[model samples]
Target chain A: MTQEYQDGNALAGPLAELFAVDVTAATGRCVSCGDTRRVADLRVYGHALGWVARCPSCEHVMLRLVRAPDAAWIDLQGTLSLRVPLPPA
Target chain B: MGIVSPGFRRRRRDDDVQLPPGQYLTEDFPVLSAGPTPNIPLDRWEFVIASETGQEYRWTWDELQELPAEEPTVDIHCVTKWSKLGTSWRGVSLDLLMEDVETTADYALAHSYGGYTTNLPLEDLLDGKAWIVYEYEGSELAPQHGGPARLLVPHLYFWKSAKWVRGLQLQEFDELGFWESVGYHDYGDPWREQRYAGD
Candidate 1:
């Protein structure tokens, strides 16, 4: 299998965190039609150190950035963050 | 990535029913959801494959018909799950075309008139899995269907086999096409289910 992009350890943190099974999943709603869809369905393109998520339904792409990899959570005003559920300790 | 939904075929609640595979006309089926049609004639058509080094081969509607034709009955399983099985098509063979041009590139990009394009490696293009189609089910091809010509690669998800194909641009490196630029995988293989990138 071909390996994915690993040039910057920077993306690894966000990818792992975003894809973590337990994280509360987030959905980006279509601004025009009010259709709800998974944020991963949104087209993601990196801009500098940050990323933008574009809605496929309405083509309304949104941008956000988090400098620190591990923090409580990245602040997204209306969008919900899918958080991983912590295992029993 | 969203779950690559099970192919559009198996989901059909109607189990015993089947549609003979081949290009279907809009007049017969009226399935507008398939996509829009390109306004072009079946007779006045041509296909060109150009190498980056400026070498080119052009086949007009008449010139293409002059070549030997093959009739293939195959099942085309679209990633969308609408398998049109037992379809028949007649067109030029990849081997015959390769004989005309000396490709210095490792890959090729399928270029269509409506700015729709897709890429394939030289190995895949020559693998006998691909064909350039012009006639469907023995009838003159309709416009909604890839008329006059289209590329059919059965092994991969159907879209990699572009519709309304006009020519091919040989590339030394990989270049993403319409769906690939969006979220679709660069190389769409049905077995691997590489429908979307990062899946």
Candidate 2:
């Protein structure tokens, strides 16, 4: 079988619409497994509902995004913290 | 609908007879996950079979390799509408894994190394219908593909085959899994196009 899944880096486009910075370049600490990795390395699954980002270490869902017709839902309960680098002023 | 990329082209083979409804053929194996790629060392890996009643069985990575394994070529259909036919895998059958376990439960929850879990009827895992595969296409299964071990249940939608599987917990009652609770079909049958709850 082919490897059709993309990394968290693939979320840059969708994430850009929500955050001012590129979210993929951030680092996320998994709340369940306690492992930390760049958001770009997280496993990403794209579906019609939204983008689901999972922690590679424990496979716990760290983030869930649902883009509705008029609104969006973003859940980060699986993530203990997300470190996005600030842009230079 | 989103913008269609100019390079997007549907891949259809002339001899394709196994494609499921609403699915397209893909030569590529797409990696779909809800989390990060777990880096589990072989020495730390273990497979367990447990019952809600407190009985449990455990198998280390080496122990699993010593058991007899089968290489079956089967088609896999994903709930995401991608089907790959005749994919080959090698692993110990579920029959062998459950041979010594005694359980009266009618349902099971497959727990992965990561905290991911997917529920299924106990019967769906027995009768030579499933395997905990560690090898795919003649190589050690890649971590992205649920390496070390992944449950293989080709009859159901691919999501039922939990990746990076660690153990099976027999339950007296049915429990919804990560995707199941969110609207994906509980019993994913590709032939019937059961991708969502109402479908």
Candidate 3:
């Protein structure tokens, strides 16, 4: 069997059921403003099933994720989900 | 343009608009498209997923309804510093799209028009964790945004979630796409801040 995240869930399952607050065990700090937000709030926005969120205070938008404990070096081993945009061509 | 740093006081009007600490102008960013502008059209579009065995699943206008759909508000971070939030998208779920397809391999490669491709594990496509979005912000997704279809992997760094999605092919070995091949991290993880060819 493939090693699974804590939920043993894959990436394409029901959005909410597969990725609840438990998935985001780690914390994500806003890259822009530097405020640390809960992984769950950052992950879901708009509504319960929302995928994005805007910081109520700083207004800096962030790509949310369940914190990856071993984020120090992301290769194929880690689950990389950064939403940073591509630089201008 | 720069982004405001954390704790920076906000002004009511354009006062806050001055370059923030990390923000940059969109014009300075890379152009995302299918290919040369002329051959790509908003009306003509296609998305497919092929198993390592060569079995293929294709989506067309009429067949699109056969799959499941969803609306998600997401924050898209480019390797560049512009973070756009509250973006909405609708499309067939990757899990629903690959329901009938069989894959013997452990990995898959997402391919697009401009020689863009990204490798992902097979589990990501089968478990309903992602989507191939055809619509954005309540509108038909535009060409610049990988209209008709773009892979949305809310889990992995957005780059592995290929845009301008044309087909998905199961692969036994990992292959790098445009950004990955160049210098972006193979898998982009935001929390860790992995944003270059090599982290």
Best by TM-score: 2
Query: Model 2: per-residue lDDT, tens digit, B61-124?
Result: 9999999999989999887777788799999999998998988999999999767788999999
Q: Which is better, 2 or 3, measured by DockQ?
A: 2
Each model's lDDT: 0.60, 0.84, 0.56
* Chain B TM-score of every predicted model: 0.79, 0.92, 0.75
Candidate 2 regions exceeding 4 Å error are: A1-50, A53-62, A66-89, B1-15
Best of the candidates, DockQ: 2
- State the lDDT of candidate 2 residue by residue for A1-89, as single tens digits: 44445689878887888898888888999999999989899877773335788787767778877554445557787899999889687
**Rank list by lDDT:** 2, 1, 3
Top-lDDT structure, candidate number: 2
Candidate 1 per-residue lDDT over residues A1-89, each given as its tens digit: 22211122233447566555522244445554566666555554342123434444554433233333233223343343333335687
Model 1 CAPRI rating? incorrect
Residues B41-108, candidate 3, lDDT per residue (tens digit)? 54465677787777888777557755668887765555445545446789878777777787678888
Which DockQ value does candidate 1 get? 0.03
lDDT of 3 by residue, A1-89 (tens): 21111221222232345444343433445656666654444423221111233333354444322222332211221122333233477
